[model samples]
Target chain A: MMSNLLLLSLAVLAAAILGCLYRLLKGPTVPDRIAALDTIGVLLLSMIAVLCMLFRTTAYLDIILVIGILTFIGTTALTRYIERGVIIEDGDAEDDR
Target chain B: MIGEMAIGAVVLLGACIGAISAFGLIRLPDIYLRSHAATKSATVGVLLILAAAFLYFLLYLDHVSVKLLLGIVFVFLTAPVAGHLTGRAAYRSGVSLWKGSVRDDLKQEDSSAQGPL
Candidate 1:
């Protein structure tokens, strides 16, 4: 029964991932795409958590942490790029101020 | 048996919420509204699923999954920040809001300030 529930949840998460993928592909603007990407990341995180339960192991927890850190950095960097048209500001250029 | 049932129900509920969030992501007309759906519902859905996992291990196996706990905390911390950054970027980059939106409070405030936003 537990496995059955896990499988069902996995199916639903997969469907959700597909839906986000559609948004990612069809998004009319760059920020729209970024938002879709962020959503997909979160969905994947939940999916992995469910998979861990199904497998009856804690080994996959590290994957979850890695995904979390990567998603945050990716989203933040993309956002900064969109706002400024550049991700990295030059430190030496600001020394005159 | 009862605990197992509870866990199943919780996981199912979380999955359903996640599906709903995805539906909103696709259906919403603008990036801002899409961010709303993606951030709030998805965050809560994942959190609930993580809670279910925590409960299951704690009750059935008599062990606390620190990783699941970490995941819950991580999601809670990051999701909103991502949404905010995306929305701010969109607005700053001049992505127009949906026509049906009632106000432009940010624009109005920026215009009145006579300074860079």
Candidate 2:
């Protein structure tokens, strides 16, 4: 049986995801959108965890882990690009000119 | 018997905290402030819920559930870093701090051409 408490936690998490989406859509700055994107990553991990518990399967965990690693790298690369306009090592910032 | 009750209580508590964090994310006037609330509150809430799930799995299942705990650990390790990176990125990308924001200390560093201080 799915516990009432897990149900409530999932509900609350859903609401948080919605709030993040609002920020993503409405944010006026690039980094603001990225902040929301970071939240989405965490939220995705939690949602996967809750889903695992509900379904009693660890199968989705691999997906969660993959998503986590990928999102972390993606966000870091995007941050570097946004901050300096380049994801490469050179300080030339290919797009800065 | 008591285990079920404890699990329920923990889950409910986690949910309430998560909701509060969401509210903070929505109501906070700036990205940095919202990141503070969203990151810490959600991390704590998820950890609590993960703990309850760990206990539940231990009590009810005979299969290996250590992996679930590992997932929780991964979450704990990554969430803060992601939030920090995003917040720093926001700060660097010129997102304005709220009007009532008191700290202009970094402005001094910027005045010297320190690349946003």
Candidate 3:
């Protein structure tokens, strides 16, 4: 019974991922694509959680943490890059030749 | 019996909410509103699903999964920040608001700051 429920949840989540992918592909603006990417990351995390339950193992636990950390870092870096042309500030303005 | 039923129900509801959030992401008029759906609805959906897993591990297995708990906390903390940063970046990059938007509070503030007349 629990396995059945897991399957059902997985199906719905798969559909959600597809929707997010559509937006990611079709999003007109950079932020729109970034938002879709963020949503996709969250959905992927949830999918991993469901998979852990289905497999009845704790091994995937660390993977979840890794994904979360990567998502946070990636989103922050992308946002900074979008807002400022350069991701890292150069102390010397003439550094870039 | 009841525990299994509750878990199933919670997971189902969470998935449904997640689907709706994705729908909103595609259907919304602007990036701001799409971010609204993606951040709030999707965050709550994933949280609910995690809650279901937490309940299952605690009740059926008679053990707590520390990782699931950590995931719940991590998601709750980061989702909003991701959304906010994306929206702020979009605004600063000159993504225009929807045509029907009534007020331009940020624009007003910028103009007021520059005004010496």
Query: What DockQ does candidate 3 have relative to the true complex?
Result: 0.54
| Candidate 3 lDDT by residue in tens digits, B1-117 | 767877877887898899899999999999999999999999999999888877877877677888888989999999999999999998888899989788888887755775421
The worst-scoring run of ten residues by lDDT in candidate 2 chain B lies at B108-117
Best by lDDT: 1
Model 1: residues >4 Å from true position, as ranges?
A91-97, B112-117
Clashing pairs in 2: none
Q: For candidate 3, write residues A1-97 as lDDT tens digits.
A: 8788888999999999999999999999999999988888888888887787778777787888788888888899999888877777868764331
Which one wins by TM-score: 2 or 3?
3
Per-residue alpha-carbon lDDT of candidate 2 for residues B1-117, written as tens digits (9 for 90 to 100) = 667777767876776677677777778888888888877987887788777767777776655576667767877887788788878777777788999998777667776766533
The CA lDDT of each predicted structure is 0.88, 0.75, 0.87
Q: How far is candidate 2 from the true structure (C-alpha RMSD, Å)?
A: 3.1
TM-score of candidate 3 versus the correct structure, residues matched by position:
0.92
Task: Give the residue spans of candidate 3 off by over 4 A.
Answer: A90-97, B112-117
In terms of DockQ, the best-performing candidate is: 1
Q: Proportion of native contacts in model 3?
A: 0.72
Clashes of each: 0, 0, 0
Ranking by TM-score: 1, 3, 2
Order of candidate numbers by DockQ, starting with the best = 1, 3, 2
